[model samples]
Target: MKAVIRITLKNGVLDPQGKAISHALDALGFKGVEEVRQGKLIEIELNENDETRAKQQITEMCEKLLANTVIENYEFELTPVVSS
Candidate 1:
């Protein structure tokens, strides 16, 4: 199984990195770039074949270590890995 986790800051949380990127873009003449929010993408390959179980495991991983639940939110997508 293949899983992709996306971790991002929640609303109202201060994102200094995102702010810096936005400012840098404006300086580089990337006009009309109103806002920027930075996030993380994690890709994992699991041995588990069951989609439901894989999702559950990934969710737990996110809750325990992949994300800071206090200021961040995480979402994931699961896909079957085809053997070639």
Candidate 2:
């Protein structure tokens, strides 16, 4: 099994990195660009194949270490690894 996790900052939080990206885009003449938000993606391969157990483990991983729950929100999707 595999998991893809997305981590993003909560709304109303200052995102300096995102702001910088917006500014750069504007400088490069990307017109009408209003805003940009930055986030992180994490992919993990798991030994467990059960969806329920995998979700539980991924949730715990996010809550414990992957994300700052106070400032960031996290979500994950489970994907089955294809056998070649």
With a 3 Å backbone cut-off (N, CA, C), the pairs that clash in candidate 2 are none
Q: Model 2, stretches more than 4 Å misplaced?
A: none
* Model 2 CA lDDT for position 43: 99
Best by lDDT: 2
Residue-wise C-alpha lDDT for candidate 2, range 1-84, written one tens digit per residue: 999999999999999999999999999999998889999999999999899999999999999999999999999999999878
Model 2, position 60, has a per-residue lDDT of 97
lDDT of each: 0.95, 0.96
Looking at model 1, report the run of 10 residues with the lowest lDDT sum. Answer: 28-37
Backbone collisions counted per model:
0, 0
lDDT per residue as tens, model 1, 1-84? 999999999999999999999999999999999879999999999999999899999999999999999999999899999989
TM for candidate 1 is: 0.96
TM-score of 2: 0.97
Q: In model 1, which residue pairs have backbone atoms overlapping below 3 Å?
A: none
* Model 1 ranges with Cα > 4 A deviation: none
